[model samples]
Target: MSEEDTALKAIEQVVAAVQRTQREKDAEGFLALFHPDALWTTAHGKVLIGFDAIADFTRSVLPGASWDGEVTYDVVHTQFLRPDVAAVKVRQLYTDAEGRPESEGAPLYVMTRGGDGRWLLTACQNTQVRAA
Candidate 1:
């Protein structure tokens, strides 16, 4: 595969991981996808710095979130800043038991390729998509 293809593939895997963990409500699995010093801003605008804060928040919310539905994440776009860094935009949808949309989020992730050739989310911001 070409370099672009490889990078895209790697990024897709990261996106898949995010969706998988969210659907499973597995906080640890989701936390593992982020870098140790990553920064994340929640949909509500709260900032979390480092893996510890992220893990704390994820563990608190993932298991007890009111919505019991399928969480789907779609990668809307990706732009490479360099061979090892990418900015990814994702659309997240939560469907209710009846498969109707419950809520939506638009998240942007800055991912960096580690020395191990794995993409780790380095910075992220999640925004709630509210109807105007």
Candidate 2:
């Protein structure tokens, strides 16, 4: 596969892992995708740095939340800034346990290819969509 293809596959896998962890309420598994120094800025404007902090945040927030519908991620774009660095834009949709729409937004993720050539999340920022 081409380098772009490989990167795309890696992104897909990471996204799948994220959804799986959320569904399972596995905070540690979710945070495992992030690098040690990763930074995450949530849609609510909360800034979380480091894997430990992120994991704690997830554990505190995600469990007991009923997620009846799937969390879907639609990749809008992917740009390789360097051979080992990529920027991705994605649209995310979340639904409640009853299948009611919870929220939708666009988010940007910066991923880095580690020494082992596996993609790891470096930073993330959510773009809040204002209602019309």
Pairs that collide in candidate 2 are 68-97
Task: Put down candidate 1 lDDT per residue, 37-132, tens digits, no spaces.
Answer: 999999999999999999999999988766766888999999999999999999999999999999999999999999999999999999999988
Off by over 4 Å in 2: 96-100
What is the per-residue lDDT of model 2 for residues 26-104, given as tens digits with 9 covering 90 to 100? 7778888898889899889999998877777888987866756767777788899998888988888887768777778
- Estimate the TM-score for candidate 2: 0.87
Alpha-carbon error at 114 in model 2, in Å? Answer: 0.3
Q: Which candidate comes out best when scored by lDDT?
A: 1
Q: TM-scores of all models?
A: 0.95, 0.87
